[model samples]
Target chain A: DVKVTQSSRYLVKRTGEKVFLECVQDMDHENMFWYRQDPGLGLRLIYFSYDVKMKEKGDIPEGYSVSREKKERFSLILESASTNQTSMYLCASTQIGTGRTEAFFGQGTRLTVV
Target chain B: AQRVTQPEKLLSVFKGAPVELKCNYSYSGSPELFWYVQYSRQRLQLLLRHISRESIKGFTADLNKGETSFHLKKPFAQEEDSAMYYCAHHPTQGGSEKLVFGKGTKLTVNP
Candidate 1:
């Protein structure tokens, strides 16, 4: 079975602290994405990487950054955690294709900035 | 700008009733659409895609270019069908492979 593993299911951090959410996929997908899921806003893309060391900003890339030093792992970073940054973060991976492929998602990390 | 819209924020229906979740998009060219479902305490998963045209778990979606809509429908909704559904659009022409998602609709199938 294909698996996308997130480092944490839940995390709590203090304001102004740095936070890291890690995601690893066993499918050897070339494309990985990070999204923040909110109640009314749904899933807003924060960042995505198509290849190792190549990153692209998404619609809501502010206050967040991503690192893809390796193929199977991608990490989301919060430089300064704030209360407004608290949300459910999801990581997904998909094979490189002509855009007809499905994305497999991880179990999500629910972060709380207190 | 490419955008996907899901008008309904929440939908409720009793078991064995027909259900339809609306999804609309605005893009320049032919769009690639997908429906993703997230069950309670589960990861988000691909429910169906427009290109496949295959029924999944008794659910089907038909793309209408005239109206620019791809609505997910099921003749009979079961209690297990209650979940959060998101509509996404993938840009095939652009070099970017990112997906644009809607605000999502939470379906509640009461027994």
Candidate 2:
């Protein structure tokens, strides 16, 4: 079965500390995305990559960055964690040439920045 | 800019009752809409897409371009239907690969 795996299901980080959330997809999809889910704001896109070594900022890319060195891996980096950054982070993957736009999501990582 | 709005934060219904989850979007170009569901402890997954025009688990959604809405409807609500439903869209432009999601609506079907 196809899967998107996130390294951590739950994480806690201190304020001002750097953090990394790793995601790997076995589907070999060309598109990978990172989104943050909040109570009232829904899922907001943070960043996405359509190709290896290429990335683009999404609607909310303020305090986050992403790295995609390989096709199957996409890493979200929080340079300096803040209390407001505590939210559920999700990773998704989709194929480019499939003529479909459905995204398969990971189990999500619930991050708490203290 | 493209945007999706799900006004109701929560919708509650009893078993066997008909349920409709409202979703509205704003995008000038052609739009592809989708409904996603996330049950407790499960990852979010695609429930249905407008283009497919097919029903899954007895749920259906119709894209009303005239009203700029895509509402998910089910004839009978089951207790197992309790979950979070998200309305998403992908515009013809840069949004084709990335889905823009709205604030999800939590559905509760009491048995």
Candidate 3:
């Protein structure tokens, strides 16, 4: 069984605070992604890293950033959190491939901003 | 642009009743489609895909290129089927690993 571990299950942060959510996949997948899931908006991508030190911005990447120092670890950083930025954060990983491949996901981190 | 669409936000049906969850897509190029389910208190997982033409847990989905749709179906619904179902797309950009997901449809199966 593949394991994608998230650093936190639930987190509380104040407005304008800095927050960091971590994800580590045991499979050493080359592709890692960060997504923010909201009720009606679905899962919007924040950022993704296909290789160490490489990052690409997603549709909703204005308030977020990501770090990939190693193959298995990907970190999502909120430079300055806001109430609107609070959401259920999901991390996923997949082996780099040209053909169809399934992504494995972590349990998710539900962040609350007050 | 590549996109996935799940028109219904919720669907309710009785156990043993036939169930269908609709999914549509708009992609300029040939794309792959996927149906993902997230059961209550459980992580989201892949339920089926159009490419493999396989049924999972009695559920199956078909890709209609002319209509640009991939709809999920089950001959009989079950209470354990209640969950958030997300339709996803992998654009013909081919190597794009980031999948564009739909808003999701919440299925509730009654006893």
Candidate 4:
């Protein structure tokens, strides 16, 4: 089974505190993604990595960053957590191919900022 | 830029009735569309994609390029089908490989 596992399902952080959300896929997918899901905004892409050490910004990459040091792992970093950053973060991984290929997602990390 | 839009924020339908979850996308070029579902307390997973034209759990979606839409449909709605549904679109190739998603619709199938 292709499984994408997150480091934490729930996280609590204070304002200005640095936070890290980790995701790993056993499927060896070459592409990984980080997205923050909001109530009415859907899932906004924060960042995505097509290869190890290669990262690019997504639609909503203003307050987020990502790392792909290993092919199976992708990490999302919040330089400084803020109240607005409190949202459901989802991590996904997929093989490179046509746009039709599907991306497998983890359970998700619900972050609460205070 | 590729974008997806799910017009309905919520949809309520009775069990055994037909269900349709609308999805519209905007892309500067040709696009690939997908439907993903998240059951209550369950992880999100892909339900179907436009290109493959496959059906899972009796749900099927036909991509209409002319309308720039890919709508998910089920002949007989099941109570279990009540969940959050999202429509996603991604580019054919290149940098980021980011999948753009719509706000999603909360589907409620009441028996």
Candidate 5:
């Protein structure tokens, strides 16, 4: 079975502290994405990496960054955690190709910033 | 700008009743559309895609170019169908790999 594992299922952080969310996929997918799932707002893309070390900003990448130093691992970083940043973060991976393919998602990390 | 829109935020229906979760997209060219579902405490997963033209778990979606919509429908909704549904779109030509998602609709199938 294809799996996308997130480091933490829940996390609490203090204001202005740095936070890191890690994700690993065993599917060997080339495209990986970070999305924030909020009530009514839906799943908003934060960042995505299509290749190793290459990243692209999504609609909501202002307070977040991503790293894809290796093929299997993608990490989301919050430079300064704030109350407004408290939300459910989801990681997903898909094969890179012209045709549309299924995206495998992680269990998600619920982050609470105070 | 390319965008996906799910007009309804919440929908409720009795078990065995028909259900439709609306999805609309704003894009210039023909884009790939998809419906994703998230059950309670479960990860987000692909329920169906427009290109496939196949039904899964009794759910189906058709892409209407004139309407610019891809609504997901099921003839009879089961209690298990209660979940969050998100509509997504991907550009077919552009090298960009971003998949844009709509605000999503939460369906409740009450027993």
Candidate 6:
């Protein structure tokens, strides 16, 4: 089974603290994405990486950053956490292809900024 | 800007009744659409894709470029079908391979 594993299922952090949400994919997928899901805003993309060391900003990447030092690992980083940054974060990975392919998502990390 | 819209935030229906969750997109170029479902205590998974043209779990979605929509439909709804459904669109020309998802619709199939 293709598995996407998240480091933490739940996390709580204080304001102005640095945070990192780790994600790992067993499958050798070239495309990995990080999204923050909110009640009314849905899953808004924060960042996506097509290959190792290559990252692209998404619609809502203002308060977030990503690191893909290795192929199997993708990490989302918050330089300074705030109360507004509290949300459910999802990580997904997919192969690069022309045909329609579905992404495999992790269990998700629900972060709470205090 | 490419955007996928699910107008209904919630939809409720009785079991064995027909169900349709609407999805519309606003992309200038061709789009690859998909339907993802998140069941209770489960992660989101792909239910169906437009290019496949195949039905999964008795659900099918037909992409209409003219109407700019790809609505998911099932003839008979089951209680198991109750879940959160999201409509997503991917730009064909973009190499990012990122999907833009809608706000999602919570489907409730009452017994």
Each candidate's root-mean-square deviation in Å? Answer: 1.0, 1.5, 1.3, 1.5, 1.1, 1.3
Better of 1 and 2 by lDDT: 1
Q: In terms of lDDT, which candidate is strongest?
A: 1
Chain B alone: TM-score in each candidate?
A: 0.97, 0.94, 0.93, 0.94, 0.97, 0.95
Docking class of 2: medium
Instruction: Classify candidate 1 by CAPRI docking class.
Output: medium
Q: A65-95, model 3: which lDDT tens digit per residue?
A: 8999999999999999999987999998877
C-alpha local distance difference test of each model: 0.94, 0.92, 0.88, 0.89, 0.93, 0.92
Clashes of 6: 0
How many clashes in each candidate?
Answer: 0, 0, 0, 0, 0, 0
TM-score of each: 0.97, 0.95, 0.96, 0.95, 0.97, 0.96
DockQ of 4: 0.76
Best by DockQ: 1
Output the lDDT of residue B91, model 6: 57
lDDT of 1 at B51: 95
- Better model by lDDT: candidate 1 vs candidate 5: 1
Each prediction's interface RMSD? 1.2, 2.2, 1.8, 1.4, 1.4, 1.7
In Å, residue A53's CA in model 1 sits off its true spot by 0.6
Assess candidate 4 and give its TM-score to the true structure: 0.95
lDDT of 2 by residue, B68-99 (tens): 99999999999999999999886555434666
Stretches of candidate 1 above 4 Å error? none
Residue ranges of candidate 2 with Cα displaced over 4 Å = A97-99, B93-96
Please list all clashing residue pairs in model 3, or write none if there are none: none
Report the C-alpha lDDT of model 1 over A30-104, residue by residue, as the tens digit: 999999999989999999999999999999898998999999999999999999999999999988863798889
What TM-score would you give candidate 1 relative to the actual structure? Answer: 0.97
